[model samples]
Target: MDNIDKMVGIRIKTRRKELNLTQKDVYAATGISNGNLSEIERGNVLPSSKALVSLSKLLQTSIDWILTGEASIIDNNSPEISNIEYGLKLNESEELIIFMLRSLPLEEQLDVKNYLRAKVAKYEKSELSSTSNHGKNVMDGNSEIA
Candidate 1:
């Protein structure tokens, strides 16, 4: 197997161990079949991008995190998590979330929680500042999406 395949296998095995889940559970969640998932996790075969996305979701991590161990996709200052891309294609939200987690160190889950809380506070402060500047009338009849 190539590097990518090996990485996939390693990530699958790690997640399975962490979650106390079996290959069967992954198969059921990803609809990949036990034998296939096993082979993929063993680095006996390469998985398609679609299958990788499914596994990422079941594992609750991002494809980028799984494949490259990089959680922040675009690496901007905002905590607005970006989408996870598989090569040129992109994974959905669940897959992206999983991929992001996969990139995180085992000890950093708490860090992520703290980071999210701080970002939420920053957003709330910004909202309050905007509202106060506009006064009561500006917000009274307007129903604008933030």
Candidate 2:
């Protein structure tokens, strides 16, 4: 494989692993077979335009990034976290939250941040409580699966 192909394959592989998705998961989502995906990741064969598009959407990146490793900038302050490329990786709800946050005044941003922190704390507490109860239930022979 040539240098560009290898680089593209490496990017694909890296993004896939970052998302904690397997080749089989990608295949199921993109309709690209596992063997073909493996070959693409290995840079043994060039992906077709259709495959590239599908992979880009499934992997939440752009074709340009996949091909040339150049991601379009949306925010200059934080290239990795606040760029259009990073936004593309977020779901619709997350993107909307980011957009709304960006629209708010500087002082309001802190309020929103605090609110989000509180929500996160509440969610973590609930999760911990549920987990502890589940463990107790399992130990007490009251778990459904047991």
Candidate 3:
């Protein structure tokens, strides 16, 4: 494979690992065989357009990004999010969430966003406290041992 093909393959492999997906999972989702995926990851062969499209959809990325390492800009005025039913294959629950979010009023959607933000803040605060406490305990334990 050439440099561009190797770069694309690296992007594919990196994105797959980021999603914590195995080759088997990718194969099941994209109908691409495990051997093919392995070869693609190793930069031995370029993937077809169909496979690239399937991977971009499954990985929630753009084909341009996968192929050229350039991030595609999403137009705010465009109905890009709503047009997800085109080639993207989302699970039922994911589809339902998008539907429900789209169905909500602007105010309700803002409220949902605020609620999620607050929940994330609380979780992060708790995690930080736990980590600090663990560090303190380790320090104290070392002092006692010494």
Please write out the lDDT profile of model 2 over residues 63-131, one tens digit for every residue. Answer: 888999897512422334544545546666766787787566434656787889999999999999999
After TM-score superposition, the amount by which residue 84's alpha carbon in candidate 1 deviates from its true location, in angstroms, is 11
lDDT tens digits, residues 25-115, model 1?
Answer: 6665567988888888887887789997776765667778777766633332223333323333444665566467656653454467678
Where does candidate 1 have its weakest 10-residue lDDT segment?
75-84
What is the C-alpha local distance difference test score of each model? 0.68, 0.77, 0.77
Instruction: Enumerate clash totals for all models, in the order shown.
Output: 6, 0, 0
| Residue pairs with backbone overlap in model 1 | 60-98, 61-98, 61-99, 62-98, 62-99, 62-100
RMSD of 1: 11.6
Please tell me which predicted candidate would have the highest TM-score against the true structure: 3
Question: Candidate 2's error at 16, in angstroms?
Answer: 0.3
- TM-scores of the candidates are 0.47, 0.50, 0.54
Q: Which stretches of candidate 3 lie over 4 Å from their true place?
A: 72-80, 84-146
Error of 1 at 91 (Å): 24
Residue lDDT tens for model 3, 1-146: 69987988899999888767789878766889999999998888989999988888666678889888898633322344545547566667766776676466444655786888999999999999977877898988843332
Order of candidates by TM-score, top first? Answer: 3, 2, 1
